[model samples]
Target: MSIELNEADLVSVSVGGAIAHPGFPGLPAEPYRLAADGTPFLLPTFGGIVYNVSVGDRAFGWAADCIHPGVSIKGADDLKNRGLNVFSCLGNTAVVMTGQAQGAKGVVTGKSGRFSEQVIVHFPVEVRRKMAVGDQIVVRALGTGMEIRGHAAVACKGLSPSLLKALPKKVEDGVLKIGVVATVPAHLVGAGAGLTSEGGSLHIQTTDRAEVEKAGLSSLRLGDVVAIENTDSRYNHGYLRGALGIGIVGQTDGPRAGYGPGLTVIMTAPKGELGSFAAPGTNIATLLALEP
Candidate 1:
């Protein structure tokens, strides 16, 4: 047996939803949800901006000595395990303290956490730098991973335009089930899922009929973990497909053709696997010959 990596960094970036501050203008809705109340938030998106890094960049995703090596923190190694990072706050109503506009607080939007010494808050750049590094950030984590129960990442190997084309056209609708949780938009599938050898599952696809036809899986990258399962599984049930044996997620040219906004399970599963995390009908507990 091998030893599991148990190194939970001393400090993890806190994340939360944004809540509209009192008397805040614009869309009069609660942007800062309970996550602003100081709860645990998980899953940071790739190439997303936190304190300094811009959206769609991986400058600060790793648990390294220097977290956000650009804007927030000057030196990455210096801020390895410090007191705290302001970006830790995920979603909450926040007041801009420093920079050009001071005291002008806005609802703390989504937080970019996970090993970032410099936290990422989703606020207008003009007013994001309320607190500097080591400042207090708030967040409220709700529910649990169970919220996405009975789901799995679609795994693949040696991803390429050709590999994606090889996927089953339709396995007879009732044969397979797919689970799509926290799905990202299919139209925006370019590079959203990296082509790493991890788990190799692609668990999501485009519901936009037109996009699926022209784009197909060609837009998807290798090692992309797409979610798939059966219908009637839950909120993400219809997302799970039983048609093509395991459902359709990536580039395909077959009978199944309805793609929708879905989650990118690429990170959850291991490298070079076919499918990770079984869907609703999948014998979750039952051992399978294909499991890694």
Candidate 2:
């Protein structure tokens, strides 16, 4: 199915500077463990160019709570309230309007709001080098009133028509089955909790080596679509048994005690409202035909 957007759906935002990673505040004598040699360290978070990573890479990084290739609109409250964050769909064009990279173009990879609302974009390493914080970037926000035909219960958020078209879907026994790489339990969810799904993401806890191995969280890669069980992310994230949240793995976190890969919500619904089948190839890279 095809959806159209009008002029009113578009909005623009300024690219803000990278957010420095503040070590766990208030922790006694080094909040967490250091390297094997007892050297102190902290993981990179928001802002700046992430040269070594891209859209389809694994989410595991050496830096804790790291957010790659961060780009945000300063004072995003107005845009967020008006659905800029919600409608700035993935695969949307992001054009650099200032700095050395002026006129450079990139693609919106995902949306996140761990500390504040921001849109994560992917640009070439060389272009990223010339980009600076506070650069002007424009996005054509377009994902509103999106729906899955014959499935009114399923709610679509932060998804672009281009992204939707790339996804593979089918009807199975009267249930709309979307392809996903894995299904994660709600109990394993961390960070970005108590946050509205408007423009945010939740972390998949991977601190415990045993739990990480058991849940297969370690194998998760960026862009993979995973089913989150027993959670409602329509408006706000909450415990709702039987609810399911289908999201894309957006960002990788360092081996923080409680943080791991981040899940950016794409579609969500109440219990028994939607179903999914394990399909490993159902990822942003595969759907959009981007280099893996």
Candidate 3:
């Protein structure tokens, strides 16, 4: 059966911001963070235009933690940045409004940070090269009020109707079956927990390599769709028996104790109405045909 949603009623509006530079905390005496192994190191963390990385690339081997691909954008004003973060949905179309990359189009991939607040956009590498940190980008924000025709139990959050349609899903016997790269056990859910799921993401803790390997999460790629087992993300991310949450790997893996690959929650069903299967090519890049 075809996936039907109220795509027409969703209002598409403009939410724009300039690229943000990588942020730091309180001007730490030493701009270094301890890895899971307790090794102090520092590298590119988040924000700015990442010229080399893009969706579909492996989320590991990078010298950075919580790294975002393409252009990371946010309004200079804190309140406006929140608007940009909350309104921009995954798979929304974005366009460079000013600077050398004017008129260039992109896709909103994800949102990150608590206080820093950024909306991640995926642009072609060449288009990204022409972009600068202060370049303004306007996203055609939609999908916040999407309705999945008959599935009242399934709540959609931070997901575009376009991306939802592009998702590998099927409705069988009233259950929505989705394709994901892996199912993250509830024990591994960390960071951004107890926070609103409308924006931001939850990190999949990779401190225990053994556990990560056992759960088949060691090879998670950016933009990869994955299911969080026993997670209730209707309002906030928390553990609930028999609940299931589906999200896209939005950021890179980190070395911090409770930090790892961040997954932006897109769909959730409290009573396990959402089913998932191991699907290798279910990444956003593949589903959305993102280039560069």
Candidate 4:
């Protein structure tokens, strides 16, 4: 059966920003962050054109922390950057407006850092190689006002209509069943909680390595769609019994105590209208046909 959405009611607008420079938290020794094991390490974090990594790679066991693949962009003004972050949804089309890769297209994959307020876009490796920091990128942002027709309980957050269609889902017994790589329990839901779900991500804590392995999330890859159990993300990322949320793995696993692989919410239902089934190879790279 086919699911319906109010596609015509949605408005697609342009939100632009320049490729951002990777930032340091301004610690006494900037650019150095200690792992959960108390080891200081410095590796590429977020921002700018990342030609090597893409959406399909593993999210954990990486040398880097909070890695955002492809290009990360943000507006110069703080308020405008928030606009760029909030408006740019996953699967939105992004285009290079300036520099050597002018007119090259990419796909919005995720959003990063509360302070950085940037949108992550995935481009072909060759296209990324031609990009540089400060190059302008304009996203044809849509999905904020999207609604699943005939399914009022299933609310969408930052999921484009095209992506919603591309996702592997079916109506089973009056429930929307979606395929996910993993299902994260409410207790594992960490950072970004109590925050708006319109943008940013909710992390799955990795402090307990054994628990991560037990949950079958040790092999999680960036862009993998996941289900968060007992969580209500319709408005904010918070815990609610019997609630279910669906999100995309947005960033890599981190070494921080409360931070790990983060997930950007796409769908949530407080009434348990959303269900899931195990499905491998269900990442955005495959669903959206994203080029590395």
Point to the candidate with the largest TM-score.
Answer: 3
Q: What is the C-alpha RMSD of each candidate to the true structure, in Å?
A: 18.3, 4.4, 1.3, 1.4
Q: Candidate 4 regions off by >4 Å?
A: 27-29, 114-116
Write down the worst ten-residue block by lDDT for model 1. Answer: 283-292
Q: For every model shown, what is its TM-score relative to the native structure? A: 0.26, 0.81, 0.96, 0.96
The runs of at least 3 residues in candidate 3 whose Cα sits more than 4 Å from the true structure, single-residue gaps closed, are: 26-28, 114-116
User: Over all chains combined, what TM-score does candidate 3 have?
Assistant: 0.96
> Per-residue lDDT of 118-209 in model 4, one digit per residue for the tens?
88999999998888899999999999888887788998888898899999998888889899999998889988888888788888999999
- lDDT for 106 in candidate 1 is 38
Per-model lDDT: 0.26, 0.69, 0.88, 0.88
Writing each residue's lDDT as its tens digit, candidate 1 over 1-292 gives 1111112322233332222112222586543322223443332222222444322222112322112211231112334222222222212234444444455533321111122222223344544444343333343321112111122333222122221222222222222223321223333332223332211113233334464446333343211223432221211222223311122222211111221222212112222122323222221111111111
Q: Local error of candidate 2 at 176, Å?
A: 1.6
Q: Candidate order by TM-score, highest to lowest?
A: 3, 4, 2, 1
lDDT string for model 2 (44-97, tens) is 665545666777777775454556543444333554433546666777777777
Worst 10-residue lDDT window for candidate 4 reads 110-119
lDDT of 4: 0.88
| Model 3, span 1-292: residue lDDT tens | 4788888888999998999988777754778889878899888898999988888888877888889988899887988888888888999999999999999999999888644378899999999889998999999999998879888899998789889988888877889989999999999999988888878888888889899999988888899999999999998889999999998888888788888888888899999688897788789998899986
Clashes of 2: 3
